[model samples]
Target chain A: MATALTRLPDERLAELLHGYRASSAGPRRRALLLALTIAFLVAVAAQVAEVDLPRLWEHAGAFFGYFDRITMLESGAGRVWADPAEWFWGWRKWGVLLLDTLLIAYVGTALGGLGGFLLAFCASANLVSNPWARGAARRFLEFCRTVPDIVFALIFVIAFGLGPVPGVLAIAIHSMGALGKLFSEVVENIDMKPVEGANAAGASWPAMVRFAVLPQVLANFISYALLRFEINVRQASVLGFVGAGGIGQDLIEAIRKFYYNDVAALLLLIIVTVMLIDLGTERLRHRLIGALESRA
Target chain B: MNRAVTLRDAAVAEMAGIAARHPQQFRAMPPARLRALALFLASTGLLVFGLWRLEFSPSRLVDGFGQLVHFLGLMIPPDPGTWSRTMLILRGLSETLAIALLGTLGAALLAFPLGFLAAWNTSVNRLVQFLSRRVLDSVRGIDALIWALIWVSVVGLGPFAGVLAILTSDIGTFGKLYSEAIEAADRKAVEGVTASGGGKLHGIRFGVLPAVLPVMAGHVLYMFESNTRSSTIIGIVGAGGIGLMLSEMIRTLEWGVVSFIVLLILVTVAVIDTISGRLRAALAGARAG
Candidate 1:
């Protein structure tokens, strides 16, 4: 570049030096074109989703207005803050329902976690040499997870009658499928050396898993199970919309009946509960992971 | 004694001598076994309490099994009623897809900037970052179904409400996820940009954003895949999608139609999952390249 520049005039050298910014224009134009394409796609999606600007604008007040109404208590009361007791008048009933939701999440997670642990071994390619059995197990887990838990709740509600039973069963089935896939993946990633040794020793299948697979995957499995429990608590709350169980039934009723204050109260309770569970489970999972790593 | 047997005997004897010297090594359970046992007992108690309070019994289980079989019998054909009904269900499926697409796209767009605000290293100020993080947490803490219900009450129902509901819920998730990804990015490139006399925004755009865009895009694609599932169910809350149709069919006791819709949903979601999986793989490949 020094030799080439020495051959050039000062005018040309200055021009070339100043021309660096112009080189960037190519990428700038390309970025603009890309942005335009994305904008076009976004517009198309908005149209397909039936986004109405005028309607949205017209209902803007109503949308925000609902929040105001929910925060409000009866006449003469400024808001939910005006009287906490009045806002949570049905706390006792809601509390019982909340407990029911927690129980459903607990039992359902336990049942599903056990089912997943058993099935994961069969589904893992490293563990099960039978292709057909592995494929069937994979497909079964997929089917369990693919269907929304609420749909399962609806079907179970019809089959088992309206109560927390269907809710628990729905959560169990969905969690089983979800956790089975995860557990199998964990099994697939384990150190195969221990498994090879166990096999060479003529250990039975169950014995091999207990000594080789379980020890390696137990920490990950427990962490995932605890995470699923946190999710299931939130899920159990929603199962009630189908009359399966949980506080969701009352929450739905409040929405339908336009009991704005009740809706706000119930939503607040649910949000707080979910956040608390998320925090608690997250700490436990980290601790479990730490213990596993230290042992290794 | 045979050579192999004598060798094995000597090894066993040595191991026994070692065990005698350090007995703890042969203990069956780990040091934390007591804690584990207590945890097991507590969980078992909770499970028993759950079953008792929820009124579960062996008789109920047996009856439920028979009733479930009867329901399966009703769904053997998996019919979708008439041709017109099939078309309606197909259209509902499309609406659900549209809602998921628009919602996820909107969320990705909104979260792109919010990511910078929420990320610790790139945030404008610590207080703003903290506040934004809390806002995103609370927003994400409320489930998408609840958002759909709330939006339904506001918008009076339809796909738009579903779109808004998904958009709102996903924004919080994407924001938190995007910030975490950003925070994990190497800061050397960003420092190089700033060292070259670039402003903070310039540094972020040229260094941080380019580095994390793939991870962020991958996350957005996964969110789209999951949102499709959420949109399918949000309709049950009257947010306007196949869920509303599903709930309606269930209400009218058209078990065949319900089964048919469920199958359609399963197939559609599987297809979406495959497509998004491919896109994410390609994105990763591009990043590697």
Candidate 2:
């Protein structure tokens, strides 16, 4: 078999199959064109919307105006930051605000993660088995996520009288919806053999879930929780707009006051924080999953 | 029967005894870990700062409720007065629809190829896939509102800014969705393409794209429907559309006008949702059939 006609001459093979296989280039080109058309439509729409890029360039100063009010970098008439000593202190203040934002995310994520884990079981179609239970849980999750975070923040702010309570509550609620759905999805796709075996052994529901279900998707749950944590941090940054508390308030103040430099600085801080969280989460996920797999 | 029950119980006890001989899970959590001091100082510190900064109090909330109810009262008997104003409302809502369409289409275009490159199984290298996926993540990590604010600042406020924001934000999302679809494509067809002396791109173009395009198109359509609601809000930031009118109405305490715009937005969203739902179902059916 290895030497069967030496697999024929390369030229012979090319000739044998020639014209039989259609060239994919036509479809490839068509796909590319489709993409280009999509882009073109978007550009035309952007034009119709009349964004006025040139005007944006002209009144760039207003951006600065909005910035200063949010950051409180300027006191009295005209811009300050002349005193180097005050400048250093302002940097410290910025750090504190950043930490405050992190704290809001931490609390929100931990509480939400815990709630999501339990709700997830009820939501999973495979686990629930009961059609009505699954439908009710799924609908509950939809209702939870449909209301935007800002809308939730506004409602919470009204209820709690502003501050971190509202921000935390809003993030927690949103997280429950988002995390619950993802968790249930993971649950649905997990191996059911162990669960079935446990059920056959006369184990109660709780015991079955504990012994059979969780071990399969625990890593996934952790991975999702970490991902949500990173998201919560970003969300925390914007909670201050509604006076829910966090560095977002400072950022908004800077924007409203037209402090462009401060805005730039705060943006830098946010970008760095996000990158760090992302990296840390990735590493933690790898470590946790690695250990889980090795143990199994 | 009584003897049979006794034998069953005796057998269970023997099985438990045998299982005890093969013990598992030896580790135990440390008691000191429970007693360890949990950090609350930072949380409290931030909470205090928040309280001070927002000037938030329970009494203020009570007071605000009255004002909220008063505003609600003012919104009663929404009068859709004058043909010109009615036309204006319709026009603003249409602009929003246009924004959603453009944004979804634009994102789909930019996302598909990049998504192909980002797919773990289809990609030429792990590095390219990883980098592209992260780029998509960052794009999706931030909310549409932030994008509107940034673009509004960059482009200087208008419907254009709103349009740009939705497109930019949706691109990242589309990339993530498209990549997942590509990853899930049947490997057999891809392998068949490869066996015919086709390169990676050839296989993807013929074998993968056809399989996933419908799903991707359905996703794009759904996004368009969702973005319509978002486009309304972006307009508040001077991006353009009904949001501008709504915000203006709110500011001027024209509750009637606000209610009219809100009703318009709800109706528009509901209609788009129905249409998109039908489109998605059709696409799925076509794929299955």
Candidate 3:
């Protein structure tokens, strides 16, 4: 049978292969079918949306012109290929703005990271050991996350008057919720042995937490904080809409004034800054985790 | 008695050593290093600059409380205006909900496979994982608002653009989240499937997906709640939602309309949040149970 099958031509062998194909069952195949149905619905939705592709084509030049102005392109390729100093000046302003944005995020994340760590410890089942206490902390985290950061910023702007303070506070609140949850999860995942050992040795709860759990999860906490800091940096750019201050204010101002060149410059700075931060965070996380694993 | 005293002294010394080793990482202070010193100075400088830039005066704050009171006085009664406009607002809200659902669904659909590929532990090859991870990074790195701005240009305005914005941004988010979940999954299950002669996809199907599905669902549902609010903002870009109306209200200084719209938005967000929370809890409970 094997020899006969081997003798078959490629196309004929493909035909013979049809019989061996697995019959689809279970939710996976159902999900595929459901996706196709959803795709059909989306097509209908697209029609209803009146996406205006023809109009876009008609207005393509104008749209492209807007982008050119925003990006400050003298020619199609010249914007990217321009002189270094000219590029440097353009890049410098953006770099400064980017730093301002990072400052906003860093302040916010630091405040939130501290708050979140405390809250997470309080919320942790092992640390708190009291269901009500844990529940309260958890609920607080939920509430913080439930409200959008922008809404929080808006409220803070109203309360504290508009500025980076509101922006920082908003991001901090968001970080607290996000990092609190992550920190709690990390706490839950810690090896029980050290905790048990500490407890058995008549160590106080605080001492156990400080010596055992903290040591175990400190790198994880830092990694999470770094990741959240990166996210807060992005969020800082977002909070400008509500009059919360940062480089986002410039982005909004550029849009308001139709200064497309400034917008492009600002956006380029943001992309580069965020990308660099992400790379740095990833490397730091790898180093920390690697060290921890080696220690283990 | 001497041995007992020695043991107590050793314990105290050991504890001091441990405290010195780990220091309270929760202090929220920069390290006492050059980098920390630089960062501290930078922060102080920024604080001064920001205070100056925003014209933040204590006197102004003291005076501003009166303005807050007056604003509060103006928003006294919650008004829904004409029935038709109210209906229009509700209709617009439903559109926003639809945008969130479809966008998140579409993003998760695409991201599911890509996320699996990106998961370092379970990927087919290093190249595939690296490429997929990079794609996820790029997707997530760009803010959703920026994605909306780009999509609005590409697809032209309306809910379609809004949906695309959410979809594109969420693809990045879901990819990162789902990949993390995949990485966090029990290796023993994968090992078990592999040991039983299962193929890679089979291992994923039998082992990985089952473990990560609940967590992925939780993330998706959370995104749904988030996207509802996001849908509002993307509408400000003329993607056809209540945000367009709200932005118009703000532009025209129609405080009455603005308040009404804001209240509506708040209600919608709060309601959706409750629903998503319940769904997430249910999903998590079922999975854990």
Candidates by DockQ, descending order: 1, 2, 3
DockQ scores of all models, one per candidate: 0.71, 0.23, 0.20
lDDT (Cα, 0-100) at A271 in candidate 2: 68
Model 3 lDDT per residue over B1-289, tens place = 6999999989787986766777764345646545757966986676566555545577765655565566566655756568987887776776777788778888989898888889898888999999998878877877877777666665677887787778888998899899999999998998999998898888899998888888998998899888887887677667776777766655554556657777777778888888889978888888878
Off by over 4 Å in 1: A1-44, B7-19, B26-30
Worst 10 residues of 2 chain B by lDDT: B31-40
Error of 2 at B26 (Å): 8.0
Candidate 2: regions farther than 4 A off: A1-48, A51-89, A114-137, A186-219, B1-92, B107-143, B169-232, B241-289
Per model, kept true contacts as a fraction are 0.67, 0.26, 0.15
**TM-score between model 1 and native:** 0.92
- What lDDT tens digits, residue by residue, belong to model 1 across residues A193-227? 99999999999999999998898998899999999
Whose DockQ is higher: candidate 2's or candidate 3's? 2
lDDT of each: 0.91, 0.75, 0.77
Question: Considering every candidate listed, which one attains the maximal lDDT?
Answer: 1
RMSD of each: 3.4, 8.1, 7.8
Off by over 4 Å in 3: A6-80, A84-92, A191-208, B1-89, B104-140, B150-158, B168-226, B236-238, B242-289
* Residue B48 alpha-carbon offset, candidate 2, angstroms: 14
DockQ-wise, the better of 1 and 2 is 1
